[model samples]
Target: MKNESKELATLDYPGGKRRAKLRIVSDRVATATQGDCLRCARVAVRNLIIDGSRRTLGRVREASTSPGLVILGGNEGQAVRECAISDPCGFTAVHAREGAKLNYPESSPWGWSLANGVSIACHNSIVRDNVLTDCTDTGVVVYCSPGTKIEENHVTTKRRSAIGGILLVDAEPFSRDYSGIMVKGNVLDASGQAMRVGIGIGPSVLSDDMETIINDGSVIGNHLTGDYMGYGIATAGLQGWTIRDNLDDARYMGQPSDRCLDDPVNPPPQAFIYNSATLKESVVQDGFFDSDFAYRECVGLIVEVDVRVPGWWDAQHLENAHSS
Candidate 1:
């Protein structure tokens, strides 16, 4: 499919209706040389499974604005599973936004998302075993949803403006706190940021006293590598979040201290953790580093944490090389 705004396929179920169990398998979906707002596929119904081992989905044109696969909505009991989404454009490969029911309810209606001004929502969804490359924004984006899992995926990007491999944020004003978000077993190799989980500043119609949206989740066992200009992992406005067992090799692309923040008086460390003021009960531990020790040693206090230097053989390869 090419030059269209609508998705190639969309499975949507209306509110207060019987949920549909749909399966889109073994199909090749692509949008090339298209205009704006072009998406490969979308699933809004419940109990949807998209699994095609040989399936290829991409947007070869740079004009594409949306993701390759979009999950708008799903029930709590039903789960949406997407596998093998590959080779997307510079935009997000998989995007799950605030759904219509969440935004257009009769009791209380809220405005569209502050990030992209779109209304979509998803829950109980799992994105796994996918390969996404050359994404401009992010490989996977989950906005204001609960019980979402992103696991076992490989993401790479050449664009330095790219945000990260996986980005989780709260953009809507839902009364309930976003929870059960898990990121694990993924290889994120990018020129910019690697992984970011946080909440943006937005007006919330659901609560008058809520200032900052908080997410309860965990980021674990992911291999993150990126340029020195960005962070391997960044978190903000999170509660009860744990970041552990992850490997980071983020370093300057050119010079040791080039484009990095330098402190003349109090220098930073080689590997360290950052916690925002709004972050409550969050812990970062057991972090393994395979970064450029020579660069860190030269910078002297530009990094604060102690890093373990691996052998030459182990340092030569990235994590899960075959998967990426």
Candidate 2:
């Protein structure tokens, strides 16, 4: 059988929800056999080989459908349990459709993420139990998905342009705009920026119209560290936003600011508040533009900061990573 494709099976849940169990295997690499393993839902699949690169993982979407669950597997060691969900060399475990839910079990022992893992561009889904490190971009990016839930994940990117532990993009293709989302219970550390926004990512008519707004969401109980760029929790092109109880965004200078004033246009701004949290120096500081970005008419402005910094020097020293 061709292993580099999705294996689909139907399951019956009593009085719950109509759910399908799927396992993606690589035909070229090691393939999984069928068995009654307790780890999966029912009549589960086994032994999905971890192929060398991202192209192998894309095969899993061969038999894609609607709102089913996806689990990412890897090869050797505790990689299925220890490393980030996918290899850092490329974008792995990516399935983009409308209305899909997925989960990845990961571990980050290195204090930094080495790859990108388990990105879901679908709408109205949940992403949980993921540990991502060293990804050059976002750990998990959500684009133009309404009523989405991003919870209980750890993202650490030590590389350049490391934006968004869990990013939300409401850009060009998002015709209806992005609203009613929740980002809660995550650890984001040492990335260039955290939770960036932009949208419209497909062969559709409105992909360019995705630059919209987000509304009616919550950002709670996240541990944000080592981001001297824009914000711990940022929302662009939206209104009616809420950010509460994100206490871990700190600085070495001992003071915390809400945001490091950066580019204002393109990605619009959302509401930000510091709750029972601390702020130092400036709750929101500015002039934080990407040194490499060549865009025109780009000015820097910081807004809606919910600063959780403990002291002054703690927050100021965060800039050292860039100058070096």
Candidate 3:
């Protein structure tokens, strides 16, 4: 705990576990009244509350732009945020889940590199029961962390980015496959700022060629309520994902539909799927096997596959074979 100023208190782990192995339970309280609240790597945190609104006494306001809470790599824990307002720093401008700089291969056409949100690289962790507001970046994000449960959280972002609120993605050097992350019962509010999507699943910012394929995860029972939310939920470069029972709370938001009249071309429905043609020739048929949403507000789901972007690994494999 901290008073007006002067270092009030400090809580340090006595070096028992490297990556959140020992579980510590307490109703007590600890506080850091200054810069960099908590950075957890392989540690377990439960029933903890982090408010990014707190800042050092005399520091510049820019200090708040830094990450309020960051969990680099761990196996188990729960992280919730009261508020996180950050600027476009490094490669995290796109805000694709965890903030990491992704460097593309020279042969790739997308670009040399791009940034994402702050990195919360953990697996099987529980990010639940938290409330975040006005986060320019992603509200709750996990990087290459599978089997994580993002549930029962309330996120309100006043600003808009390419991706916002409750995202699960992978941003490693090489391509990888992961599954079993569950996103359920989260309330995403964009009434103030209007977000692009409430919850985003699969691939960081670089899914054009399928660098990462998230499979068998579930996005269920999540509600999206806000103004002009392009898609309540959006998925790209993913397969075998169970998307069910999710709805767009347009009635609550006093909106008849999610599409906007200003946009010339009709925007996709509440649930949007991009790059389906690239994923598989017939992967997206009349209805997806693992998805079930029957609501006018939800518009079931829509898949738009851009054929221009070359399949990343598919091209790489062909080039490697020719070289060999």
Poorly placed runs, candidate 1 (over 4 Å): 1-97, 100-120, 159-161, 173-176, 191-211, 226-229, 253-273, 286-324
Q: What lDDT does candidate 1 reach at residue 304?
A: 28
Candidate 3 residue runs with Cα over 4 Å from true position? 1-119, 158-162, 171-175, 204-212, 251-269, 278-324
Residue-pair clash count for candidate 2: 44
Best by TM-score: 3
- Model 2 RMSD in angstroms: 14.2
| Per-residue alpha-carbon lDDT of candidate 1 for residues 207-265, written as tens digits (9 for 90 to 100) | 12224546577788887665432345544445677778877665533222452334321
TM-scores for candidates 1 onward, in order: 0.49, 0.47, 0.51
Per-residue lDDT tens digits of candidate 2, residues 1-324?
Answer: 113233332333211123332223442321222211223222212222122233234322333221112232221111122121222122333333333322222221110122234444445555565555544445666665566566777666443334345655444235534465667787776543333321111111112222334444455566666633334443333345555566544331112223322332223222121211112122222322221111111213232334343531111101000000
Error of 2 at 279 (Å): 22
- Candidate 1 vs candidate 2: which has greater lDDT? 1
The TM-score, computed over Cα atoms with residue i paired to residue i, of candidate 2 is: 0.47
How large an RMSD does model 3 have?
Answer: 16.3
TM-score of predicted structure 1: 0.49
Backbone Cα, N, C clashes tallied per candidate: 15, 44, 12
Residue 143 lDDT (model 2): 62
Please give, for residues 1-324, the per-residue lDDT of candidate 3 as tens digits. 111111211134222122122111211211111221133222222212222211112111343243222222211122222222122212221121332211110000000021123334444555555455444445655565555566776766443222366666554422333466677898887655545557766563222324456556677888888664545565555667667777666322223245322322223444444445324322332323232222212222221323234432111000000000
